[model samples]
Target: MSSSTQPSDIIIGRTFGALFIGVTIAAVLFGLSCVQSFVYFQTHRDPGTTFYKLVVICLWILDALHLAFIVHCVYYYLVSNYANITAPMDVVWSFKLQILFEVLIIQGVHSLYLYRIWIVSQGRSRILPIIVGIVIMSNSGVAIALIWALYQCSMFSELNKIEWATFLTLGTITFADVVIASSLCYLLATSRTEFSSTNSLITRLMVYIINTGCLTSMCSMAAIITCAVMPTNFIFVAIEFLLAKLYVNSYLALLNARYYTEVNTDTNNSDTFHNRHGVYRPELHVRALDDDELQVSRKDLFKHLDDTVHPSRSVKEPALAVTTEMNSFSSV
Candidate 1:
């Protein structure tokens, strides 16, 4: 090949190669998410979890559609236009429509995280949720603007015209992830109980929250950096293809974690405790509670702690205190 055509060949390789790698990773994540959803529905048959099951179903459908769009875009560029040297520069309809699915998936996952923060803080921390909500909404707007810009342009190189939108969208997403993770960590740390087991569980939850947030944030940062450094390549587009799958998989992981926590809690503690009469008494056997009930249980935990510290001054029987054993992310 002549020297003049070498750069074109390299660009083609990078453009299609990135798309292939991204779609491959996304397919793997999607498969894992499907397994998680199946396990969740098979195990959690309670009426309280119906809403969560529906959310999972919706996300799975969106993810499947998103993957289809990516596949079509790649096939259109690489297979259908195999002999066309200028094919990589042309834009496809699937490329623009995928932005809509991406924005919707992100909105759903971020909303769930916000709800968890609300429950963990017992509705006391309003400022953080409001700020995160605003950022998320702004990001959605930027995504729409980006789609519009893509629609207006016939060539991939034209994306530079609305580069600001791309930067804003990724920046807002990273900001929201960081804020949500930090808020959850702070709230969980402050909710530590006197019992070591309870505190340990809270610490585990904090670590999980941080890891989930960091994964998504790192992906967004990678996309942003690639877009800025190589505006003419499709590496950023490839990263975008994986973003929805990451969000869906993370949400499913959060939900499925409850089963492991419940098993661990039950196995570590005895079902019955000896009372003051030296007789074995059955522990309070309430079903797993949702977020609202979890909040009530937390209050009972604090009240029980107070009574234990000052038994002589207490008048009423102690409230049932098993909040520590319950999974913090049980509902949201």
Candidate 2:
């Protein structure tokens, strides 16, 4: 059979093919996140309150649904009865479910960061929280625009409208991520205590805030650039597909770090600063409060530490440590 396909059509198909690969990788990361989450539940006998458990459960459900929808989109393109029609790419309905799921996942991850900032600030900062809330709402609005674009846009010529949505959504997310990372770093810096151990712990947390926030922010920026440069191409789609995986993985890494930190803290070892890999582990020390004076809840401990102290690592191995340490000061 001989056929002449438009260059644009070929580009679209190739983009979808690349998207399939990206989605597959995302699915694998999702599985890894689930495994980490399960280990977290098993290891931390007293992880947190029921609300935290509920959030984890909801994230699991969202992850499962996200994967399912992506798989369906792939199947539709690769094996469905309408596969020969090239309808999947031309129709908005084909991708709305996946896009919706992506938005929900992003929102959940963003909310977690907001919670971190709120706790770290001890609810004192009025402006930063409001900015984050506004950014989140803006991102949500972009998601709605995306859905509307998908619904109203039925062909390649109409992709211009969706491009605007893509730009706004990704730009807002990147802005929000930068805000989170910078805010955490500032708060942690100001919260440093005179005690070496507590300062070490805060330093560790600052590392994580940088890695996690920078990672997501960078991903979102890359997506925004691609979307802007090649609004009609699928390259942006491929890049954006990984956003959810990054979000889920970053959060899971934090949870796993909490487990390792608890084990180290309870061992009562002097060189708790370094782990088996010789990486500086974040260790916390309670100085002012005598053992009998007050029993500190993890949340209270972080709050009390933040109230009392003020201020203040490397890359390579240290970067690995920061990425590995997921337990924020609140969890400690």
Q: Give the Å shift of residue 208 in candidate 2.
A: 1.4
Cα shift from native, residue 115, model 2 (Å): 2.7
lDDT per residue as tens, model 1, 1-114: 112333365566677888999989988988988898898888667666455777889999999999999989888988998868777666788888888889889988988777
Specify the highest-TM-score model's number. Answer: 1
What are the RMSD figures for all models against the true structure?
Answer: 8.2, 9.4
Q: Supply the TM-score for candidate 1.
A: 0.78
Consecutive 10-residue window with the lowest summed lDDT within model 1: 305-314
**Which candidate wins on lDDT?**
1
Task: Give each model's whole-structure lDDT.
Answer: 0.71, 0.64
- TM-score of every prediction relative to native: 0.78, 0.75
